[model samples]
Target: MSQPRATAIGFTAVLLWALLALFTVGSAPVPPLQLNAMCFALGGTLGLIWAVATGQLSALRKVPLPAFALGTIGLFGYHALYFAALRNAPPAQAGLIAYLWPLLIVLFSGLLPGESLRPGHLFGGLAGFAGAALIIVGGGTGFAPEHLTGYALALACALTWSGYSVLSRRFGTVPTVAVALFCVVTALFSSLLHLMLEETVAPQGLLGWAAVLGLGLGPVGLAFYTWDIGVKRGDIQMLGVASYAAPLFSTLILVLVGIAEPTLRLALATVLITGGAGLAARASLRRKPTVAVSASSDG
Candidate 1:
């Protein structure tokens, strides 16, 4: 597919993921590991069916084991931490903390074959970090000492996801195949974790089931599949910049759902993360000319 189309799909994934924070929170009362396992298993089943129908199941054999392993760890590890963080902290705070992956993605993308690190990226990363600090200090959420564990988990989520995305892009194969395998692996791991550490709590009402379905289909299922293609083929810099919108979008949804109240800290965090991404992307744009020139000379 064309880069433009891939970029659009990337943005679509971002929007869906924004809604994910809200839905994940709705699953509360449900154990994190159990919830993740069930949702991911369902999503994986859907993806597997699609892969078969689209004739991409054969591509699975071509996918290297390391790539599939990393994809599973990235997907499952990130969500595991994310769900735990949401359970312990306010949705906005957790979302803001986890959204740090966008800045990390910009930095990691520079390590790709045709990408380069620049001064703006450094400054932008710092700015984003500063924004995250402000969120924590300015009464965003997670003030108690007990909440520190969740905060740390959210931070780890950011790091794991950024590294996962970079590696995926650097070694991407067929999107559907990769995502399907990732879901399967994550589901198995999550289920195992649930058995070891958490108790199961089935969804109680129509609203609860709806939340599960939304997350499984939108974020866990289609979002990861499209993201695999996007990071491989789309403008990574653009997606990095676009990801800053997630926290803001998630916060709004939480507010609408009456799960969270908006705060001054969240507003400031929006400015910082968004502005930092723009600053980093400016560097990306400047570096593109060099990449184009290099490609041309090589050709």
Candidate 2:
């Protein structure tokens, strides 16, 4: 992909991520877990069929299956944390905290590629950290002991997501759709495991029911395709900048729905996150891919 289109695709993925947040919180009567499982099932099925029909199932075998597998499991955690956080924390707070994956990715990138931290990276990192701290202090939802697990899960979600992003860079030729397929496959297994070993809850109504499909088509499947193609084909770092938009969009959705009460703290968080991450990602954008891997390595 050209740099411009890749940039658009990345930002577009952020919109998809935001939509995932919106539907998850807005699905009032749906048991989020069940809905998640249903969505992944449908998405995986669709992707699997498409790949097989096109004789592209071989693409799955060519990518880094281990990294992809771990990433998919992380995606499962992300789904759970996001759904629970919406109920436990304010929508904006949840969005902000969850989106901290960018900083986590930045930090992790330092460890992986031995990239020296730049002035912009330092300031950006600080900004994102401060933004998160401010958001936490702004107090949309009180930090309760019950909310402890939710917060931990949310942080884990961010970290795991960062890990996935870094790991994805290891594979050079894996198609974006293949990545989506792997994630959905992993999610399907994780959901099934949850259903069997844990308590299962179902959506309460048609709106919630439709949310399952929407989640699959919009965020779970298509978003992955957009993101993989975007980041994979160009500067992954530049593509990452679009992620900051997710919280902004989520905040708007929350305000429109009357679930998120506006505050100056949120505004600061937005500026810090967008500005900081953007600065940091710009530094990363300077990086050129030094190694290439074949899809055959996936098997």
Tell me the whole-model lDDT of each prediction, alpha carbons only. Answer: 0.75, 0.64
Q: In TM-score terms, which candidate is top?
A: 1
Clashing pairs in 2: 62-295, 63-298
Per-residue CA lDDT of model 1 for 1-299, tens digit only, reads 66666667778888887897778767667877888887788888888888777777777777787887788789988988887887887666666678778778877887788777788877777676666566544554455676777778888989989888777775644454558778988999899989998877888788788888888888777788777766776767667766766656777688787887888878887888778778876776676553221110100
lDDT of 1: 0.75
Report clashes for each candidate as comma-separated counts: 0, 2
Q: RMSD for each model, in Å, please?
A: 4.5, 4.4
Candidate 2, overall lDDT? Answer: 0.64
Candidate 2 local lDDT, 170-223, one digit each (tens): 654666657656666657766776676567666658877676677877777667
Off by over 4 Å in 1: 81-99, 128-155, 289-299
Error of 1 at 39 (Å): 1.3
TM-score attained by model 1: 0.82
Candidate 2 stretches greater than 4 Å from native:
49-55, 61-64, 80-98, 111-116, 132-137, 140-152, 197-202, 239-241, 281-299
Query: How many residue pairs clash in model 2?
Result: 2
